[model samples]
Target: MRRLTAAVAASLLPGLMVIAIAGLPVPAGAAEPYDAYADEACDGYFDPLLLERGSRCSGSRERSCPTVRHWTPRRVSRQLPACEGVAQAAHPLHAERIQSSYLALRPDHGAPRAIYLMLHWHRATAHEAVNYLHLQDLARSRGALVIVPDVPGNQWAQSGSRNINQHVAWVDAVLADAQRRYGTGNLPVYLVGLSNGAAMAMHYACARADRIDAVMPVALPMYRSDLAACSFSQSIGYVQVHGDSDRFVPYRGNLWFASAEQVYARMRRNMDCVDAGAKAARLESPLTPVDIRYGDGCVGGRRGYLLRVENAGHTWPDMETLSGRDRNPYGLIARNFDATLQGYDLLQLAAGR
Candidate 1:
């Protein structure tokens, strides 16, 4: 239940759906079913009122309504699953943290490629928006059109001001535009993101799971809650990358969010709710150790994956090993992992293409 279509899961929004990361029993004080998050009967459990309209149900699944969400100021002050003061420095390395209120996109190189929707991390700048352009050549090589966009002002804007809904609607418009302008729009749409953008990708997929085919998130999570709340939603192929060495967004998680392991566990239980008994296993990648688990329980044909970067840092899992010294507080990118190629391949599997 995409709440990833493989990449998303958000705060007011939604964990990974799988790959043999780790298994976890439900957390203490965790909501039972997704609807179990409903403590007050203000409106229908899934209705827009409780679900949206400031129902206050979005904070923690344990609460019946949404906790008053404070606006995470864009740029340096972004409110997210923060990295304990390390994000501001760690971010510039991946995508410049300068705030950009609008989105930027790169046209699909050509035909014979699937259309990809790529989102940027929170508080990213327009210039930084091109950070993932390296995937451009790679995607074209795979006959896929990559649409990398800076999330409006660096975030999908998770707020009860009807802000998140509006942002999602805006994305809907953008997808429609991509469909009409780019011929590849009709092709299976795959979402990919880094960090917070990855969460956005997953949340967007869950809300609009019908249209999404696959999702690839690196170093962040948000996907299982909705599945727990409403297992009737569509299944989506899920995959993610995480590093134990990451001080920021560490593999070790918190109560509000999940570590890579917890995300995988939650996904498994959520799938069980729908009777999709996807099993787990270990698989090795060229760069590092990974686990490839599959079952008929997930969306787009019950496929799932997870790449556990051993002793890596707050960086994109790319084929290159960044070794130069930088002033940023966060460290360097993990050396020798091919996120680009792997992402494309995962999408293929997710879409069963």
Candidate 2:
């Protein structure tokens, strides 16, 4: 008789009451089922301040009022779990400071064959150098590891800026890091730079010629006074390109910069090139006229090239069309010859690839 009476009472009440009487699992912190349903249901009661609900109940699930939830903070125990075993000392993070910041790119499909250390011009970032030269293309084609490092203050150490030894150390550190991490054992190092960066490359290459394989300096603005400081130990593959109409770093010479011809002559003299074995040619292209002068039969069988672009000025040839914030406002860019392509070609030529 008591069980029948209880069943009849349960049938008259809500389903939640039935669940509570049956002792089924319910969500913790849940309110009384009757009150919760009244709060969550889309009934006729509406508040003007509440923009979410309609004036009247729509009887649609989409228009239904949201259920209110109360969250309580979980308590944390001071004791560690027994399964954690003995506590060990936490290892602290240690950071080593480097001199310069750099951007590096490696080929996706193959092991890198060589390391190309590309230096950027004064007041420019590594990103600009990579974009302006389309260096990724070189990485893809030659399977070369390209690294563009920004000099401190975005300017390479020069006559009066900072200590040149520190800059040299930075370059050494970059090479060491690359070799250590990538296992670039016995791989050739190619130094490529432009303008102020070009001068830096020349300085470092001269200082460490035995380790470097080749160097290509474009629009080099070498100081005449600094010539006495650079003592070339051994000649490597040397290539330079300068615009005849470059006003910034004048083609002939300037008050502060040495003439391109003079610099080329100095390189040849240091390399001990035999003039009789030198070759000269003029190539006419739709973009610009190129005068190529190559000297061979130097000490250690070294080679040097000087490419003079006619009517071009103070710019990396064929970079105007590239997408970047850099603008050649100082001089005109020659579309005829691409310096980036020539750089890779010359590197390959030196490597006998």
Count clashing residue pairs per candidate.
Answer: 23, 1
What's every prediction's RMSD, in angstroms?
17.9, 31.0
lDDT tens readout by residue for model 2, 254-281: 6667888889888777676778766766
lDDT of each: 0.47, 0.59
Q: Give a tens-digit lDDT track for model 1, residues 1-353.
A: 33222232332111111001222222366434233223343211221123224442211121111111232223212221221111111211112332323332332333545766777665554334333224433343455555554454456654223466665666676666566655555688887877667666656765776677767777774433533442215666666677666565667764444677767555544333244555544322222334344444554354565667664555565421112221113333332334665456656765556
Q: TM-scores across all candidates?
A: 0.60, 0.68
User: Which runs of model 2 end up more than 4 angstroms from their true locations?
Assistant: 1-99, 320-327, 350-353
Best by TM-score: 2
Candidate 1 residues lying further than 4 Å off, grouped into runs, are 1-110, 126-129, 159-162, 221-232, 268-300, 319-332
Cα miss at 148, model 2 (Å)?
A: 0.8
